[model samples]
Target: MNETRERIALLSKALDLMTDRPIRVMEVCGTHTVSIFRQGLRSLFPPSLELVSGPGCPVCVTDQGEIDAAVSLAGIKGVTVATYGDMLRVPGSGSSLVNERALGRDVRVITSADQALEIARNEKTRLVVFVAVGFETTAPSTASVILDAHREGRGNFTVLNLHKAVPPVLEALASDKNIALDALLLPGHVSVILGLSPYRFLPEDHGIACAVAGFGAEDIMLALVEVVRQIREGRPRVASLYSQAVREEGNCLARDLIDRVFEPCDSSWRGLGNLPLSGYGLREEYSSIDALKRLEISINDTSPPSGCSCGEVLKGKMLPRECALFGRLCNPSHPVGPCMVSSEGSCAAHFRFSRGGDHPWKH
Candidate 1:
């Protein structure tokens, strides 16, 4: 614990020395958002150093059109929609998976893609469609399940592929002139698959400092200090602070599996709009398991909630509380937007930890 305090003090000193302007470091990982809140790391920062949440939460950034497509599949007579629990309460255009489930639609909350595959194997008559949503970290697991289904000839199984790539979106964010970001805290889990190579573009191309960070408070603090140090030295570079789990080349086998099963495609983000080559679709070889093709589902372009500023929040342009309906209308119990529905969401993090105006940044 003393070691933790010492690290915090060092990071604080670095920020105090380097932060002449508001240095906005966005953490592009939902787990990081939760960890920052849980560890009270935001409060430890100097006033000039600000921690902002980005479109890191897969569930939170999932476009409404995709959610509607999943809900539509759930309502089908012989189809069962399987998804992670975080996606249950997220409202679609008119209805959510939870509401559909309550109305007797077959929507099962699953922990992993393998569980959804097992459901397909057990229920021969019912078509199981797994809502495959995540970054590279979870995409390989989904790819593994798809490979297994293909090998076993599990004709009943299909995947609604909503998997996104982190690096592409990061490039898009960096290119955007509206988001004045100083540094990036990359997702450790995603880095475990992509390695440090994918994030090199941020530092090399955009002159932004980045650190692949772990979830612990000490890990985050150490990463923050490194980012500040890079800025202080006038040398922005990508550094891996979570070297224990992530590597420079990442997991070659996992990346190979993902490449084998999926192909890059243009994908729409909640706030960022359609980014080029930001999403993954099942490869033609696995088209038999591609739910969108098999079910003839079309994802219509949809807008966010009427008054929700989730898009701005996801882009780090606005804080969760800066939204007009953050707590008054969009609480966890009754979420008006995806940002409030997912536990890793920025709005949910703010609601859970800073609703009482205790967040140091609010001052």
Candidate 2:
């Protein structure tokens, strides 16, 4: 639309104003990744401005261990594992949730968290475990579902809380010396719950510029403008361009709901190693609903297969093509890592939008 074009123009002007040095701005949202590529965002920027994808995609960042845990739950008799459609194909220990779903396992893909609650209510005999994966955006809904189930006395409903917090991963990335990021475009949806306040550490502590960005061409463009302006001014502070949704405190009610029902635990991510307090777990009172507890499943807790550079890609040290399996073996049809399976995946976005073309940053 006209709005998209105007935003693109604004983004170009912002990049033009960045006459100091190469500005490495990363979009920290999966939806932003798809939008950036689908709208040809890189094409709009000059060689001086480089936009990198970050560990923003919840499905992509959902650790292999978590998937393995989910798969193990599917292995249990009379236990149904429900998840989003995007998570079905994500590989987990040489197998996938999709393949397991096809093998007549009780794995159902639901659109919303409430649907999982419904399944639990209807199938009282079957233990329904919703594989909850996402950041603040989806966490609220998952928390709401857990609250609803408890209020309605649906004892069969349990959530395998693989929900991840963004700040830890961001901190991990910032501390790693391999990456040379100048600024980050934070995920708009996540800012809705955790808010831009949590991002204070990145700018204040780390001296990295971060702009909270909204999804869509216009929104992304505006975020770029903010990032560029901040860098140009030499002021590394967190700015919220998605003010329509994100706030400094975020949705406190939703956050309280999650805090009440779940507790933070050291969880692993696909590319990122074990981070402190990155994962959430259901409260002990809800242990009966905890599928892993009820089913008595243990995660394999193994490392990635040899020669997979998913860790490098997740750390923002390597691009998708840098991985051996990227295009040759890991296509959309056959994904080796979570980064290639999901639409917002870095590999998927690049292959879908930038492959076979000379990237502006390359020249």
**TM per model?**
0.96, 0.93
Instruction: Count the clashes in each prediction.
Output: 0, 0
Clashes of 1: 0
Q: Residue 200's C-alpha lDDT in candidate 2?
A: 92
Pairs that collide in candidate 1 are: none
Tens digits of per-residue lDDT for model 2 on 1-363? 565566567667766766467878777788888888886666777678888788888888877777888887887788888999889988888678888888889899899999999998888999898999998788889988888888888878887888888888898888876677888988888888887678899988877888888777777777777777887888899988888788789989988988888888888887777899987777887777776776777665777756677677766778888887778888888788778888888888887887656643322
* Candidate maximizing lDDT: 1
Candidate 2 ranges beyond 4 A from true positions: 1-7, 356-363
Question: Cα-based RMSD of the predictions, in order?
Answer: 2.2, 2.6
